[model samples]
Target: MTYMVLLAASFGYVFLKAWQQRNVAFDHVWWVLPTSYAMAVVEVIVVTKIVMTGGNWLAVFVLGTGGGFGALTAMWFHKTFLTRRE
Candidate 1:
């Protein structure tokens, strides 16, 4: 359960942060503000949970793996679904 939550939190944290950055770069204030707010909230939760519970090597590995996939998926998701191309 802990590992699963950590995985999800890490994935969400990275995705929102990356999405926020993309929104900013594209000059989309509407997207930027909300993503920023969400990212901050998630960041707080992820850090607090990890700090309070502590993790073994396996948990740490899961966190890293989730983050890696999150970043890759974020870029693809924003470009493929969010961006408007003409």
Candidate 2:
């Protein structure tokens, strides 16, 4: 499925970035943004698919929004706190 491919790509990106930037302590965190955003998009797509298949739309919306926000918050924290400290 498209989701699987996207997930794999994100993983690959993370892996390559980590490998290439192994000397930098905060480099992994920077590379995480792409994976995190891809995951959020995947969550939205999955939720939409479930809703279209007769699942609860409200639940889907709630979960998708929460996941997206959570990922963004995590990225923000990593940038603001973790990266800044190093």
Cα lDDT tens digits for candidate 2, 1-86: 43444344334334333333441555665555565666566556655555454655554454445445544555555566555452
Which runs of model 1 end up more than 4 angstroms from their true locations? none
On a 0 to 1 TM-score scale, where does candidate 2 land against the true structure? 0.36
Candidate 2 RMSD to the real structure: 9.4
Q: After superposition, how far is residue 68 of candidate 2 from its true place, in Å?
A: 1.1
Cα error of candidate 2 at position 46, Å: 14
Query: TM-score of the candidate numbered 1?
Result: 0.86
Give the per-residue Cα lDDT of candidate 2 at 80: 65
